[model samples]
Target: MELLRSLTIGQYVPRASPVHRLDPRTKVLATTALLVVVFLARDFAGLGLFALFLGACLLLAQIPLGFVLRGLRPIWFLLVLTLLLQVFFGGTSEGTVLWRLGPFAATREGLVQGLFVTARLVLLVVATSLLTFTTSPVELADGMERLLAPFRRVGVPAHELAMMMTIALRFIPTLVEETEKIMKAQMARGADLDTGGLVRRARALVPILVPLFVSAFRRADELALAMEARCYRGGEGRTRMKQLRYRRSDALAAAVVLAASFAVLLPGRFRW
Candidate 1:
């Protein structure tokens, strides 16, 4: 529960750093480019460089390393499962085996593949966290709406999609807090959530989940009513108070991101 509360995935951190001051469009584009580079990377050398770049970004953002990394704790199980699956099932029988457990074997090639894949997943999460950490929910929605505006020509509901995404992101922390409260209330009533097998513990969550779902629905209804009370409508004619504009800093940031992306691509292309 504490870990869930500590998650920085959808939460925004306010700071005076350059990254925070960057235009939301610039950050969105840079993050997308970085994700593309991460997927294109072919070897550990390229990944190492990308890691360094991401570390520098975090520093520039003035975000604490611990805060950014704590988000990984909730996903550690998935990461480990991915690595283990790759290590045991990724390589061919001809490859050198590093270890054996019954019929399953971990090969050197498999280890490399596992580490590379896991690194990609970790970097992807961290890169996205950087975007949410620096950009406010309103800015994120505006930027996403702008980025997707081109798709509107194809009859896509870009503004509505962006609004939905913004609401989801805004409510993630709220839901987590609500879940924590529900769990505590249950615990105070002698609900035994611990000291049980996986299935048993999952069953124990039924009581907590019931009220959680009820509360979530109630909150959603309240939110809808509140918006209606304010005479809210779709984004057809909506305008933002703080319009997004690209300044010199945004241009410089874009250039730097592009250059870094090119650097990451070069190694994979030329085998440097």
Candidate 2:
């Protein structure tokens, strides 16, 4: 299915760029900070500032804009639906009426609200996709484990949690590929997956899901056995092939991110 091709969240692109060279922990924390700014933003100016920073990060990563945006193709319908809802049924009813359709009338306030919400959603996706595109799953896991290690004083199992999260992220592309293969195999067997009503199409997908689930479980079992064979214990006493260390670049990057964050927050906070 063409749907699988648009997914870029789990796929990594290797490049000799500043973003890729930074410490993984720094990137992870920066991503978290940007997401916080995205959620805290209340107006277009704040969101626009965040968008500008995200665009710069995209450029530094050496990833194609087209490839990063391809992840949005699958969610176009969702974005449209969200926009339409906010335009038609916003929080307040008092504003200049733009258009009317039966019981629902689009208002100026509703339009602004719709655009703001949609922008946030778009920025959120691009920010996260940038992280995965730059950092491999292994690096992500290592960073997360180290970041969470301080919480190990409690009953938390940082290593296991990171391992699980990494494995799940790593399996996304594999499962997508498996789903495509199953879909094609069914298509060749005279399966009519297309050209059907809504209900009929829902029924058509059932065959694909069953086989896909079975395949996922089979793969999981094999992986578990393989790990056991290698005596893969938890992260305790395990050393990395390449230990992560924060370099001078990481500090400069952090300083830039901090300044950019304050710049974004202040623009909409107090008149500048």
Candidate 3:
């Protein structure tokens, strides 16, 4: 159950909205632009603007605030650890010491570093979460393939790579559900997944892994046979069912992303 629960990464929420309908290429590009700005943000003000942008995107995407925040819960411990490390180990020119206890010294710069670093992480996660929340795996793969199409000249199997990524993303939820079912069955047969030490808990995962692997291989074999029967070859000369095209909405979205990046970089630009 614990491992099953841990596999909750990249779960998509079903929603019918403009954000969901936008060209996946637009969403992917916008997310990438935002991520670049996030890393380029030099101060707290820029980071705060990044957070506001993320919140705005989440709202536009119609994803619940609770769901967006839920993803952060699992990483709370790591965030805390980073905060503590920054608070204690970060110092520029031995700035004003806030406190000293048992060979550990906390300074003003350290405090600033800790809070800003943590805030940056929060903003980054929220931004990326918006993309995953709005775009489906299939569309994302199509977008990726389109974006990487130029690499085909270099003998890169861009389409094949995209297909593999799409399949992996598609199976995450299915595998999670399967693991849950297996866990329930094992529990019915008197297996306590929680009550054990580290080694024992790891050993207990063997049963789950075996079934998961077996089912995965079975699925792969079935897929291969089906493809072969249909005369499917590699990504050569394959056409798309829904050809991705950039629309007015996608153009507007890209414009907004560009504006936001500029806003974060130069807040005084719009002052009149």
Best by lDDT: 1
Give the per-residue lDDT digits (tens) of candidate 2, residues 180-240: 9989999998889888899999999998999999999999999999999999988889878
**Which of candidates 2 and 3 is the stronger one according to lDDT?**
2
- What is the per-residue lDDT of model 3 for residues 1-272, given as tens digits with 9 covering 90 to 100? 45556432466666987788889988998889888888878888888887887778778878888877878888889899989999888776468899987988988999899998888888888888788888888999999998889999998888999989998997787778888898788879887778789999998888778988999899889878988999988788888799898899888888988998998978534432
Instruction: Report the C-alpha displacement of residue 4, candidate 2, in angstroms.
Output: 1.0
Candidate 3 Cα lDDT to native: 0.83
- lDDT value, residue 224 of candidate 3: 82
Query: Which candidate comes out best when scored by TM-score?
Result: 1
Q: Given candidate 2, what's the lDDT at residue 199?
A: 97
Candidate RMSDs in Å, in order, are: 1.4, 1.5, 2.8
**TM-score per model over all chains:** 0.96, 0.95, 0.91
lDDT of each: 0.91, 0.89, 0.83
> Which structure is stronger by lDDT: 1 or 2?
1
Clashes of each: 0, 0, 0
- TM-score of candidate 3 on Cα atoms, chains taken together: 0.91
